[model samples]
Target: MKAAGFGYHRPETMAELLTLLADLPDARIIAGGQSLMPMMNFRVAMPQHLVDIEKIDGLDSINLRDGTLQIGAMVRQADALASPVIKKNCPVLADAIAYIGHQQTRNRGTVGGSLCHLDPASEIPLVCALLDAQLYIASRRGTRMMNFRDFADAPLTTSLAEDEILTRIDLPICDPDTRHGFGEYARRSGDFAVVAVATHLRFAGETITEARMAFAGLGAIQARADRLEMFATSQKLSPALIDKLAQEAAQMPAESDLHHDADYKRHLAACLLREVLERILRHG
Candidate 1:
């Protein structure tokens, strides 16, 4: 199938982009086109106007400022994977990005695109959920910041208004002593995850001071293991605790898809989470 004919507008500045967006209510913003183009080609998406924001400046940087990792919305996946700042400040994110599509896709895939696409199995949104990311949104009226949990509305949907652009992603940097781990299972390399788990632990000597656990591919959006995360705090890492957490993860609600059943997805989630948690303990 071919995409329906549409108007194309490439804005050189954010001001111009905002104006175009405000004027075209039915317009869709195109960044990397990794997701939108496919949908357009399939006729799954038929926007009357396509606004391209690639020419806009200051939307492709990766910086660490005021203890926050600020990644511009246009930062490409491959660039982010190779970024020293990402690797140093958020290693789990770097690890997860390696599992996104293949080299060719990652080469053009943008961070903001993935977040907006909000695939159930997308690694970027999963990491953002685990890290409690902040999203900066802008429009002609004003700008606002949203929590990742609130920004994500439903599958393939976000809370972004028609005229708002996601400007950047803000991730609070974890403590240097925080240990992080990520693991995922896919039928093949570069495929979307069947089940993926990410976690970070800030330890005071032997006891956990803080723990964040999040999983993807089990629901409409990535879910944080709140109960398990709460249980992990002030607890010592041990085989028993790991086993218990894995069991709890296996009981989390899962949705069946064409490729896998709910039970199988739960099983995979448990196994992946256990592996990630155990790896963190081993390396810590």
Candidate 2:
């Protein structure tokens, strides 16, 4: 299938881009176009106008400041995956990005594109959720920031207004002692995950001081394993405790799709969570 006819406008300045957005009806922002192009080709999206921001400056850099990692929304996945700032400050994010489609896709995919696409099983949003990242949005009105959890509304949807553009993503740095782990199950090397787990833990001697656990491919949006985190915090992990956490993961909300059933996904989640937890214990 081919995309329906549409007008394309490339704007070199944000002010110009915003004006186009305000003036054009049924306009869509095009960055990376890794996800949107396919949707348009399949006729799932037929926007009357496409505002390309690729020529705009200052939306592709990676920086670290004041204990936060700031990434421009237009930062290419490949650039991000190889960025020293990202690798040094947030290595777990790099680990997750390694699971994204492939070298070719990563070369063209943008951080903002992945976040806006918000695929249920995409690795990018899952990491953002686990890190409690902040999303900065801009428009002619002004700029506003929101938590990543709030930015995500549902599968393939976000809280972004039609006229608003995502500008940057801010992620807080974890404590020096934190140990991170990530695991996922996909049908093939480059396919989307069926179940993915991400976790980080800080231990004081032998007991956990801080812990975070989140899952993707379990429901409409990525979800944090709150019950498990609560249960594990301030407690030393034992065989019994690990077993209990796995059981709790099995009970998380899961939705069935054509390829996998709810029960199967739940089982995968339990296994993957246990594997990641065990890896952290053994290595850290």
Candidate 3:
């Protein structure tokens, strides 16, 4: 099926993009067009206009400023994966991007598009939630920052207003003591995960001072298992403790889709959680 008829506009400046968005409130903003194009091809989305933001200057750069990693909304997944600042400051994010589609798709998929699409199986949303990343949005009213948990509302839905555009992603730089790990289960390479988990730990000597765990493919939105995260901290890292937390994490709500049953997803969650935790403990 062909995409429904729509006017296409490529804006080279942020001001132009904002004007286009505000004037055409129903227009869809295209970054990499990775997710939107497919949806359009499937006739799932029929926007009257496509305001392409890729031509906008400075939206594709990755920079670190004032101890925060600022990623432009139009930054490609491949570029982000290869960013030295990202690799050093947030290895887990790099690892997560490595699992997104393949090299070609990663080269064209923008981080802002992925987060805005809000697919439950997407790695970016889960990582964003795990790291407490802030999304910067622009609208006629002005710019505003929203946390990942609040920005993403459900699969294929976000809190972004019709005239708003996602401009950047702000991630706090990881401290020296921070340890990160990521894991995912997919039927094939480059396919969306049946379940994905991202975890971070801050340790003082041998004790875990802080910890966070977020899971995708479990609910209407990517979610952090705060209950299990709190339990894992302060406890000595051991196979036994890892197994216990994994088991507890399995109790979290999981969505059942055509590909897998609820029980299987729950089992995968426990297994992957343990795997990630063990790896972090060994390396930390």
Candidate 4:
């Protein structure tokens, strides 16, 4: 398939990009071009105008400041996976990205683009939601920030307005005492996860203090069961507690496709939760 012909505009400045976006209400912004290009090639998306922002100034910085990992919209996944700041502050994110496509794909994939694509099986949004990261969106009018929970509305959909562009993603620096781990079941190393789980655990001596869990490939969007996480914090990771967690996860609503049944997805969720929890307990 070939993409429909479209007008292309490259904006070297953020103001120019925003202005172009505001002017061309139906234009699609291309940053990394990894996600959008493929869809365009398939003719799934055929915007009349393309506002390329790869040359925009001040949009690809990866830095840690004031207890947050500030990643610009254009920061490539490969670079992010290699950042010392990310490795130390949010290793779980780095781990999750390892499962996204291959090095070539990650080399061209942008954090903002991936999150905005909002694929139910994508790793970036799941990590953002699990870690309670903040998203920064901008437009010619003004800028505003929101947490990932509000940023992601549904699969392949977000709260971003037509004229707005995601500018940056702020990931909270992990607590020194918090242990992070991520696990997923995929057909291949670089394939979308069949079912994935990201978890952060805090322990008071040998007892668990706090726990955070988020899932992918289980619902309309990546989700967290606050009740389940809070319940995990209710007791140590004993065999009984692990069984309880799995049972709770088995009840989470999950959609089914032609390849997998709803019951199968739910079973995978329990399996992933059990695997990740045991890993954290053994290593942390």
Candidate 5:
């Protein structure tokens, strides 16, 4: 299907962009258009006005300040993946982005676009959730900062109002002591995962001090393995404990889908989590 006819406006400045959004109530912000374009092509999105922000300057830089990694709204996934700063500060993010899509898609996909799209199976939102990132939003009313968790509402849905524009994403610097791992059960190299696991383990001597786990492709929103994290924290990993964790993960509930049954996804989640946990523990 072809996209419905729409009016396009490319603003050269943030001030002009804000004025457009204020005037056009049904306007949609277009950055990389990797996600939105598809929706429009399928006729799922029929916005009458597209306010493109690509011509606007100052929304494409990466910076580090006060122990946080601040990425602009227009930063491409490919550019972010190759950034030395991202690699050094948050290897887990780089690791996850490698699984996103093909190189071409990454080259055109923007960080703000990915987060706003909020696909439950996407790697970007999973990383943002695990790292506790903040999203900076702007509107004619004013600017406000929101936590990523608060920004995500449901599958393919977010809390961003139609008139609000995502301006920046701020991710906390990964602690040097934090050992990270990411694993997913994808049918192919570039496909979305059937089950995804992301973890951060901090060790104090031989004991596990902090264990944070985030999972995707199991629900409407990326979920945290609260049961698993709570059980693993402050607990030394043993053969028996590992076995128990795997069993528990396999039994965790997930919604049934048309292709895979709930039980099958749960099983994959168990396998992926155990594999990543073991890998991170062995290496770190």
Candidate 6:
């Protein structure tokens, strides 16, 4: 169905967008609109005004500063996936984006849009949690940075005030010892994942120094598998240890949906986590 009556304004600059957002507190910020358009079509969101930021200049660049990679809010997913900086600094992010929708959707979807949209089954959130990415936000008051873990409140919900616009995402550069892997199970190539896992392992010589694991498509918010991570890090990086961690991760709380029951999702999570851990351990 066509979107209910709404007004649209395409801002040419960040300042202009901020002013418009301040004036129209309830207005929805549209960047790429890949996720928003579907919600609008389904009548899940009926904003009175849409502040389109696609034409706003300079919000589509990717830069490396100091030891962090900064990606502008409007950077397309396809561009991000092809970015050498992203590949070198945050390969897990590149891997996660590779699993997002199709080429067309990736061309039209923005990194900021995906993070702000906060779909529980999406890859962006899981990447954020795994990398401990930071989100930059701008409002009439000033700019503030939020940890990804705190920025996302629930599925499709964020802590962003209505007047705040996500400006960029800041990801730490991957250390030489850092090893990462991403895994997901979807019914089809372009479908949302039934269960997804992103794993980051830091190896010191041979023993596991650190392990960070995040999960999607199972909780209201993308979450870190803390118990699993702790267990995996405390043990040797072996197939048996990975299997035990996967079993523990599978026991974590999971939401049930019509497509899959909680028990089934738990099993999938365990299997995928083990697969991802094994791949990273073997390759790195």
lDDT (C-alpha, whole model) for all candidates: 0.93, 0.91, 0.89, 0.88, 0.87, 0.90
Measured against the true structure, the TM-scores of the candidates, in listed sequence, are 0.98, 0.97, 0.97, 0.97, 0.96, 0.97
Off by over 4 Å in 2: none
Worst 10 residues of 4 by lDDT: 233-242
lDDT per residue as tens, model 5, 1-284 = 68899999999988889889989968888888988998999989999999889899989899999999999989999999999998888888889989988899999998889898889899989988887789999999999999988999999888988778999999988887788889988889989888898888788876779878888888888867789888889987665666777898898879877788889999998898889878866776
Which candidate's TM-score is highest? Answer: 1
Candidate 3 lDDT at 241 equals 85
Which residue pairs in candidate 4 have backbone atoms (N, alpha carbon, C) closer than 3 angstroms, thus clashing?
Answer: none
Cα displacement (Å) at residue 41, model 3: 1.0
What is the per-residue lDDT of model 2 for residues 111-156, given as tens digits with 9 covering 90 to 100?
A: 9899999999999899999988899999998999999999999999
Summarize candidate 6's per-residue lDDT along 1-284 as a digit string, tens digits: 77887999998988898999999856999898999998898889999999999888888999999899999989999999999989998999999999999999999999999999999999988999988999999988999999998899978999998889999999888899888899999999979999999988888886788889999988888989888888878567888898788779779899999889999999999889888888877876
- Candidate 5 stretches with Cα past 4 Å from truth are none
Looking at model 5, the pairs that clash are: none
Sequence-dependent TM-score of model 3: 0.97
**lDDT (Cα, tens digit) per residue for candidate 4, span 1-284:** 78899999999888888889889858998878888998999999999999888888888998889988999989899998998888888899899988888999999998888998999988998899898889999999899999998888888999989999999999988877788878888888888888898988887776779888999998888887787898888477777888999999999888997687889988999999999888877776
True-vs-predicted CA distance for residue 69, candidate 6, Å: 1.0
lDDT score, candidate 6: 0.90
Residue ranges of candidate 1 with Cα displaced over 4 Å: none
Sort the predicted structures by lDDT, highest score first.
1, 2, 6, 3, 4, 5
TM-score of candidate 2 on Cα atoms, chains taken together: 0.97
In terms of lDDT, which candidate is stronger, 2 or 6? Answer: 2
The superposed Cα distance between candidate 4 and the true structure at residue 199, in angstroms, equals 0.6
The prediction achieving the highest lDDT against the true structure is 1
Q: Cα deviation of 233 in candidate 3 (Å)?
A: 2.0
